[model samples]
Target: MSEQESQFLLILFGGIFFAFLMSLFVVAMVILHRQRQVKNRQKLEQIKSEYEKTLLNVENEIHQETLAQIGRELHDNIGQLLSLTKLSLNSAKPEKQQQAKEYVNQVIKEVRALSKTLNLDWVESLSLDEFINQQLHRIQATGFCETSLQSDHSFAELKKEEKLVLIRVIQECLNNAIKHADPSRIDIRIHQNGKVRILQIADDGRGFDTSQKSSGSGMYNLGKRMETIGGKFQLSSIVGKGTVVNLELPFSV
Candidate 1:
C-alpha cells in the first residue's frame, strides 16, 4: 500500500474511535441522571415522613396544654366560686325562698360534679383491649344507653401512645353518637390479623350521611393520626341504621 493511503486509513479509524467514546459518555450521563432522580424520590419520601411526625407531635403537645388549662380553670376558679355561692345560700334561711336557693345550689353541685370528670388521662397507658372496654363501661355508666364490647383476641401489641390515640378515637365516636344520633346501644369490637389490629365501633344511633366525611374535623383527625402510623381509618353510616367506625393499625413489634 502507498504511504499516503495508509495515513488516510489511520485517520478514519481514529474518527470512529472518538465517536464511540462520545456515545459511551452520553450513555453514562443518562444513567447518572436516572440514578439521581431515584435518590431524590427516596429523599422526598423521607422528608414527608418527618413532616408528618412533627405534625403529630405538635398536635399532642397542644392537646395536653389545652387540657391542663381546663383543669386549672375548673379547680382554681369555678370550684371556688361554686363553693362560695353554696355557702351564702346555706347562710340565708327563708322557708319560702329556701327551695329556690336549693335549686341554685343543686345546679352548682352538678356543675362541680362535672368538673372532676372532664379530662381523662387514664387512657394514655391503657392497652388496646382495655381501652375499648373502658369506653364501654363509661358510656354504660351514664345510664343513657347501653354499650357492648367484644374482642376476637389480644391486640397486636400496640404501643401505649397508639393505644391512647385509638381510645380517643373511640371516645370521639361515642360522643358524636350521643350528640347527634341518641343511639340506644353502642357496640365496640376488636380483631387482629397477622399484622394489623382492627377496631370497629358501631352505634345504633340515627346515623347521618357520611358522603361529606372530609368536612368533619374529628373524623379527619382520627384518620390522620392512624395513617401516620401506617394504619387505616374508615367510617360508614346510614341515616337511619347507625354509624360504624373502623380503625386498622399495622402490627409492629
Candidate 2:
C-alpha cells in the first residue's frame, strides 16, 4: 500500500471509534435519568399511600367517638325523658297528660337532632370554627368546666380529609383535658396569621411535663397526623399553671 493511503485509513478508523464511544455515553445517561425518575415516582406513591391510610384512621376514630356520644345521650337523656313521660301520662290530672305530651315532643326533637349527627356528611360541610364552637358548648353544658371560643371568623379553606383530621385532633385534646387535667376552664381560639391559620386550645388544668416521655403515644400520633396534612402541632404545659396546644396550618395566597 502507498504511504498516503495508509495514513488516511488510520484517521478514518479513529474517527469511527470516537463516534461509537460518544453514542454509548449518551445511552448510559438516558438510562440513568429514567432510573432516577422511576425512583422518585415510587417514593411519591408511597407517601400518598401513607397519607390515605392516616386519613381513613382519623375518620374511623371520629365515627366511633360519635357513636359513643349518641349512645350516652340515648341512655342518659332520652331514657330519663321517656320514664318521666310515662309517669306523667299515668297521672289522673289533665294537666299531667298535657305535660306528658310536651315531653314526647321534646324527645322527638332530641332524636331528630341526634340523627343528623349519625352520618359523616357533616365532616365535609362543617367549618372548623363551627365544630370548635359546638365542642366547647357541649363541654359547657356538662357543667364539668367553663368553655369559651374566640374567632376572627376568618377560616381555613381545607379539604375534607384535612378538616376531618384537624377535627379529630381537637377532640383528642379536649378529651385529654377533661379526662386527665381536671381544668376549671377551657378556651379555644381560631384565627388567621398571614398565610397560616392558627388554632390555640388552652386550659386552666393540671398540666404535665412535655419533656418527659409519655407512656401513651397520643402526643406523637397527634403530631404525625398534623404533619400529614401539612400542618404543625405544638404543646406547652406547666405542672400546675395550665396547658396549651397550638396548631398552625399553611394556606396558599
Candidate 3:
C-alpha cells in the first residue's frame, strides 16, 4: 500500500472508533438516567407504604381513645342520669305520677341518643358535615370550649377511606386545641371552590411560632397524614392571637 493511503486508512479507523465510543457513552447515559428514575419512584412508593402503615396505627389509637371517652360518658354522665330517673320512678306517688312519667320519657330519649353514638359504623353512614357537627357537640358537652361548624357546601361524596382519614385528622386537631392550646373557642369551616375542598380549623388560644422548633408529634403526624391522602396541611399561629389549620384536598381524588 502507498504511504499516503496507509495514513488515510489509519485516520478513518480512528474516526470510526471515536464514533463508536460516543454512541456507547450516550447509551450508558440513557440507561443511568432511567435507573435513577426507577430508584426515585421506588423510594416514593416505599415512603407512601410506610406513611399508610403509620396512619393505620394512628387511626386505631384514635378509635380506642374515642371508645374510652364514650365509656366515661356512659358511666359518669348517662349512667347517673339513669340512676336519677330510676329513683324518680320508684318514689312516684299518685300526685307525682305524671312528673315521674315525664322523667322516664326524658331518660328514654337520652338513652336513645346515646345509643346512636355507640355505633362507630355511623362514621361510614353519616355525611362529613354531620360527623363534624357531632364532634362539635361533644366538645360543647364537655364545656371545655364553645365550638361551631359552618359549611358552605356539604361533603357527602367522600370515599370510605377518605372519610376515615379526615375523621382522624379532625379529631387530632380538636384534641390538640383542647389539650394544648387552652382555646376558649374553636371553629371549623368547610367550603369548596372549583375542584378543591377546603377545611379550616381555627382556635382562639395561645398559639406558638411556627418558625421555632417544637417537640410535638401531633403536628408532624398531621402533615404526614395529609400527604398520604394527596392533600396539603398548613398551620398559622401567632403567640397569643391563636392558630388556624388549613387543609386542601381534591374533591375527586
Q: Which candidate should be chosen as best, given TM-score against the real structure?
A: 2
Per lDDT, the best of the predicted structures is 2
Let me know the TM-score candidate 1 reaches against the reference structure: 0.62
Local accuracy of candidate 3 as per-residue lDDT tens digits, 116-216: 76646767778889988988998898889999998986467887667777888888888889888999999999998788889999999999889998886
Q: How close is every model to the real structure, measured as TM-score? A: 0.62, 0.93, 0.75
Model 2, span 1-253: residue lDDT tens: 9999999999999899999999999999999999999999999999999999999999899989999999999999999999999999999999999999999999999999889889889887788888998889989998999999999865547888888989999999999999999999999988889878889999999998888989999999999999998999999999998899998888844
Q: Arrange candidates by TM-score, highest first: which order?
A: 2, 3, 1
Task: Give the lowest summed-lDDT range of ten residues in model 1.
Answer: 117-126
Report, for every candidate in turn, its global Cα lDDT versus the true structure: 0.73, 0.92, 0.83
The reply for model 3, stretches above 4 Å from the true place, is: 3-8, 81-120, 193-195, 208-212
- In candidate 3, position 150 carries an lDDT of 88
Error of 2 at 194 (Å): 1.5
Off by over 4 Å in 2: 1-7
lDDT of 3: 0.83
